[model samples]
Structure formats: C-alpha cells, structure tokens
Target: MFSTALQSLSSHLPGCASSGGTSLKANLKHITVTLATWDAVWEVYLDPKWARQQLRLYGAQDRAMEQFFKKLKKEISELSMKRHGRAKQRVLFVGAAGIGTRGDWGGDAVLWACCK
Candidate 1:
C-alpha cells in the first residue's frame, strides 16, 4: 500500500527530459490525500500551525489530527532527498504569471525531482 502510494505520487511527476512546465510533470503521480487524515497523522510530527494550514488547504482536517503530518513530512523529505540527492536543484515557474495564483515552475521542478 505504501509503495503503491509512493508510485502514484512518482508517476505524476515529469521526467528529466520533459520540456513542459514542472506542474504538469509534477502532477504525473497524483494522490488525493484527505486533509483531516493528514492533519491527524502529521500534527504529532510537525508544528500544529503548519499542519493545520496544510490540512486546511486540502479540506481534510479533523479532531485528534497530530503527528501524522510530521511523520508524513519526514518520510516525504527523506524520500525526496534520496531520489534527488542532497544537491540543491533549481526550479522555474512556468505557468501563469502572478503572485499567489501563478504557477511555480521551480516549485514544480523541485517537487518532481524530490518526489519522483
């Protein structure tokens, strides 16, 4: 199950050869994780505010949501580093141009590199 989920997330990312923007590549391995579940699990591992914000964005927050986010974050971070190595990679935002709403190429690239 965990491997499947990781594979799903990896498939959403773009390959190094892809010319399209990072968002499209990054979204290759898509997984719909509930905010509540994430909060409940991550809260114990991370800050409550950070976990709450992350879960709220996904609309999945629920009571007793703690540690999960922290664990998830640690796992993801470790996995990402393992995949991409310790070197810092550059990301270029390729989507629309704006402040908050604009697409983040750099962010997408980083995510793809880390998650893939």
Candidate 2:
C-alpha cells in the first residue's frame, strides 16, 4: 500500500518566494502524511506557487528542470522519512491547483512529464 500526502499552498503568498516558505511546514503537515516514502518515485503536483519557486528558472522545454524537480521532491521525501523514522513505498505531494483547474503551460508540462 502507498501512503500519499497532498497539501495546497494558501492563496495568501507574501513577497514572492521570500515568505513563500513560511507556510511550507504548515502546508506539509496537512498532507496526510504518515510513514514517508523512501524508495519510490515522488510524484509532486506542479502548483504555480511551487513551479514559480524553482521551475521558472528553466526554459519552457528544459528537460533538466523536470528531473531537477523530481530529485528535489525525492530528497524532501527522504527528509520526511528521516523525521518519521519510517519508510513507505509511495506518496503524493498535491499542490494547490487540483484537477480540471490547470489552465497554464506549467499544468501541461507536468502532465507531459508525468505521462512521459
């Protein structure tokens, strides 16, 4: 079984990415996390908030950025496992934007990345 967690960022952002991390821990805490995933791929939602935080640095077609996001999320999951001292096989990092609401290139990019 997979223990997935999904957390959305508050629409209330403060000063771009500066205070963006302010709500990170709180948001993460709400992700329904239990035992963290240790060896499985980390599938994180591509929220505009998160995408803007790091994804914006790469070009639209930059493949490296995709892997970068994957590695970053995986590391984060590892940290989560360390904190909990347990490991699962899967987890979900859902962003603020949910299904049928993605209306931007970032949305499409995530789909492509995930599906590919």
Error of 2 at 41 (Å): 45
Residue 103 miss distance in model 1 (angstroms): 32
lDDT of 1 by residue, 1-116 (tens): 75667567667764745535655324533433453367766666687787678767544422222234345556766877888885344333344444433323344443333333
- Global Cα RMSD, each model: 20.8, 22.8
What ranges in model 2 sit over 4 Å off?
Answer: 1-60, 87-104, 111-116
Instruction: Provide the TM-score for each candidate, comma-separated.
Output: 0.21, 0.28
Which ranges in model 1 have alpha carbons more than 4 Å from their true place? Answer: 1-63, 87-116
Q: What is the C-alpha lDDT of each candidate?
A: 0.49, 0.50
Clashing pairs in 2: none
Q: State the weakest 10-residue window (summed lDDT) of model 2.
A: 1-10
